[model samples]
Target chain A: MRRNRVLAAVAAGLLLTGALTACSATGEGGPVTVKLLQFQEARADVVKDLIPEFEKAMAKKGRPVKVDLVTDILTDDQFRTKITQQFYSGTAPDVVDMGGSNVTGMAGAGYLLKLDTYLRTWDGWDEYYPSVKKGARQRDGSYYSVPHEASVQSLFYRKDVLQRLGIDTAQPRTWNELIARLKKVRAKTGEAPLVIPAGTAWGGGSWTEGLLPIVAGTGSTLYDEKSGKWKLRSKGLSATFDLYADLVEADLLPVRDLHNPNPWEPTKYEKFPQGTLPVAAQGSWGWKYDWGPEGAAPIKNSREKIGTWDYPALVPGTEPAPISGGGFGYSVNADAAHPDAAVELAKWLSSGKALARQLTAVGAVSPRAGLADTAPYSNEPSLLQAEGKLKSSIQPPLGDGEDRVSQAVQSATAKILAGEADGSQAADAFAEEAEQLLGSTRVAE
Target chain B: MTTVKNPAARPTRRRRERAALPLLLGPSVLLIAVFVIAPAAYGVYLGLTNTQLTGFAARDPQFVGLENFRNLLGSADFLESLGRTGEFVLWSAIIGQTVLGMLAALLLRQKWLRGKGLFGALMLLPMVVPEVVASLTWASVLSSESDGTFNRLLGLFGSGAAAPLQEYPMASVILINVWRGIAFAMIMFQAALEDVPDELIEASRMDGASALQVFRHITLPLIRGPVFLYLLLTTITTVGVFGLVYFLTQGGPGQDTEITSIYIFQSAFKYSQIGLGSAASVILLILLTILGMTYARLAKVEV
Candidate 1:
């Protein structure tokens, strides 16, 4: 009896394993399913809108390919963490949606399928702006990700609030001038003047949106492409830290609320719309997706009330050192079973109508120069304005461990803003931590 | 003599019993080997490699012996995380849960207490609520908003809304964990308290012993085993805590609350340094093992 039971149990286990294996294998039936994993919250709706179009395109092409999109609504840091976990377990989706620095890092490390060969014959690849395409290409000039949306970031302010308070709303040419303006706005309104994403929960936004402009304004930045080194302790980096410290010391930045899980929500979506916060660094999408009529606040008078300005230089005389990045880039997994189908799906995702839908939904500045003439692109004034600035904006080169660098910078910036560490001390600590996090050989200076 | 003669002949009763036992347990043994042992073994192997989430190394990982372990030992973040984790366990499990749970159990044991069933249910309520809900509920209560429950309570005393989570992150995490975990200790202590003979307490009272004296001398000694058991369980569970703290703080206001679990998670998944993460996990495994062994020795039982 016991022997019989053991035999039955063994058979059951075998059957279960076999069933699971069969289910996991690339199916041999009707339509090939391409899994898309994405963390862009705004595109969740856009993807839903595009599924029918994708099906129709496939049917027209007679490929019978099915798109299965898996959207993770977690914040960027959280979703990327989960994506890495999936990569380790060999269960990652066929296509992934990532941003400039992160997608570049993933591509550099060979997680993404090289798309140069695939794109050489594709017609629309050349229409992308050179800087935009730079993000999708590796060190060896192999194209991995297909760059779609170009992100244009700058300071967003309430024009009506500034005018009401008798303050000048002109774009400041330098960091000192911006501070002077903020001091005036604060003294006049007696409210929090600027909101820099500060806490660790804000992730790289703390460094990228708030600190990088200051660094660039000083004529140096984090990633030095020539040596492939992270310049952790530079004059520019220290200056950036000082700028953040100044904000905290002046009580200009909302440090407390920035520690919340959705730090941007209160500062950008709620306070910015209500005119409580005068200025915040925002992408073009910040208006439409986060604070416009389609956003959480839905402030009706947003178009008239809001204004955008270029992030200023560190000194008064130099031009505004603007920074733009790949807002969303799509890539295929190297390990995906249906790589060809995944490639087809990626192409479809970046094509005219589907890409237009995404660009409209996200209100992102389009990288494809031709999209500027598209109907949907023409409709968004904010996007059009941002696209005009993309030519002059700086697209910083990314390194291998950009995520860790971002986290390390974010942690140090957070400590400074929270008053846990002084500026010089925080910079020193950040340099050390980042060097360790990125591994020493990755850092040159 | 029959057992010795049964080598090639019919099996003896003891032999049959042993053979039947192995056959009966074979399936479960196989399941455990496949599920638990295989992953554990794989984890150890991963710890020895230079495998990352991306790169050529990810495709073909090369073993680096003890490099990851050395790196972990030398890492300030990992060491700091270890220290913070120790503090969290000490406060949340050893002191907070055990002491508070014991007090609740003592209160509930009073014969004249009203609505014992309702009180019992209330005590068990936090244990039943989902972890995400519990953490979020605490977040709302402790927020910096002036209308938040904690701040509102302090308003009558002329105090402003001070976000305890932002100001006293570690304390807030410890308090919430205690709130969530006291149920286990309470229920266990209640059972232990019930097992304490009432006749001895009554006799002690008749001898002019006060309630406190009886609890300290007789009541406490009887429940010593349960106390150790509770500490042991809470220690292990508290050390492995992830989800609640992850949601509440994500290991920051600035790494102030970065416990070992969070650190390991960040190293492996967030940094995509899977080998380093796996090494840290192995260290964590050993640390927990040592803790478990120490607890077993203290409890004088196989734990």
Candidate 2:
């Protein structure tokens, strides 16, 4: 019995060891582990396909590279925890997908590799939009990352609902016409005329993007470049907050209950398709993923019923302003074992050719200008409409203090909507918070 | 004549046994020092510096003395998180363990209980389930949407789709923690209750003592040690409630459910404030140590 027990123990130990070994093994290789971590939910399936391609390409060059993909569907808060833990332990992934705001802080910490040398040599670098290129580079002009994809926020409206309400299907160019039409639609259909996701970090951040054009169009600087101070108390900002507050008060948005947490991503698309929510202010990325093939399949022949338009200006005096949205570039880990290989992969990932391939594989818009005019995307009118909005898009201001400013804006808006604060109070509170967080700081550049 | 000879000259035997004790305990002591004591000491050291995880070479971390601790003490967010953690531990550990454990002990002592063995096994189910799995399951059941199982069940009783986490953040987390932790308390209490002398209870009954009186005077005193130990264990476990908060709410509906552990996680990982995160952790450790020492005193008294 004792001998049998000993044999059983040995067998169990061996089996456990073998199982652990098998789990960590990424095929037969010289054992190069590239940890790829991302926060976005929509990118998972595309990454699942892309990793094997990357591995195969590396293998062809006699490099036994294994991509250890660690996909996390994290909220803004959770993503912070994950990035910090990895950075502190010096065990961060070889490739990290981070928000644009997070990049500066990480770069400051010397966690990200400088990629100016690679960027200078890389072909197709000029194809990217100038703003996107600027956004990817560190303030010191040391390029740290490259733009992966670009997204632009647009007004998504149900053409059928607009027609039913006797509102024009043609896009509204100014806030006055848009609000009038929204009120008319609300009166006619008894459904929410607009759906804004207010509570979610991404959702709230989207509002900042949407409002930037209005702020910029007003010829008011939202952030003082020299002082690195946020101008939330500016008239333009106050007007924007007031406009949003008015929309909520006018019964045009979902009730406070519906705006509970992170705005329900799929629900907004579903409601818009179902004609329950007549309009949604969201990113162009939502059109494909949230409304297209992978998204909730709206009714058959519902293509004509959906239309994209630039977010109308805050007033008739201003031009249509839309915040341009785009994916941030991949940063090579400064401490990566194979920095050259990592840089090479990053370069390929950001190149026009690689981006085009990715755009095709996953229905994402390339950050490269004119890429959307080709093939599959060009055939889709909604995508074409989104691409059109991207032409006049203004990039949101980037600073080390943007996250705190963004949160203050969201909190103030929430309070205003909750009837606890007025528009001016909200604006004042936001400015106060921003000043405390950013007033003493200088812009990195 | 005055000098007493050692019995059989057993110095070698004593030496052999003395050497064996050190050999047996050496590895365990080494492991504790390395894994536990070293990290804790390092945490204190790290907390005093303004370190960022990323570029250690570019920006040298400055020793900030007690500035990090002072900042944390003044931070409303940190204070709010500490309060939430305290509430969670108090209700989930103290109230949860006491009631469920006592009920379980009483049930186990019943004579006519059907499938007693099966029921006992079932009671231990939650303790055996992985913490992540339990958290995920509870998250699913209490999800914000109408598709959640709890919502579906509530619909039958005419309660509309209400997100438990959003509506009652602390209560919802406490309920889940209690459900997951009751098994440990129940099993411990059951074992303790079993060791109670039947003869003592019989004597109390012969003196015309009521069931309640016998339980209060006899059974309760016998199981006091286990009860105190269970409380200490539960308190320590509840102080670090991370998985449930992370999996379910992510400390949200606007930081309503933010606990100390979640805040520390966010500071360290999200904000990349390694020093600040470590400071928060040390503060948490201090709070836990005080609670532990208090419990230790209580446990000694019971013994």
| Best of the candidates, TM-score | 1
DockQ of each: 0.36, 0.24
What TM-score should be assigned to candidate 1? 0.89
Can you write out model 1's per-residue Cα lDDT over B1-303, one digit (the tens) per residue?
354554645457778888899799999999999999899899999999887875433566779899889888997778989999999999998999888899889989998999989988998999999999998898889877788899999998999778898789999999999999898899999999999998999999999999999999999988887788888889889999998898788887778899999988887887787888899999998998898888878877665
Model 1 chain A is weakest, by summed lDDT over 10 consecutive residues, at: A314-323
**Tens digits of lDDT, candidate 1, A307-328:** 8888787643557756774577
Q: What is the C-alpha lDDT of each candidate?
A: 0.81, 0.70
CAPRI-style grade of the A/B interface in model 1: acceptable
Predicted candidate 2 versus true structure: per-residue lDDT over A40-70, tens digit per residue = 6656556666778777888888985677777
Model 2 clashing residue pairs (backbone):
A80-B269, A80-B270, A81-B270, A84-B269, A109-B55, A150-A326, A151-A325, A151-A326
Could you tell me how far off, in angstroms, the CA of residue B244 lies in candidate 2 after the best superposition?
Answer: 2.0
Taking all chains together, the TM-score of candidate 2 against the true structure is: 0.81
Q: What lDDT is reached at residue A127 by model 2?
A: 76
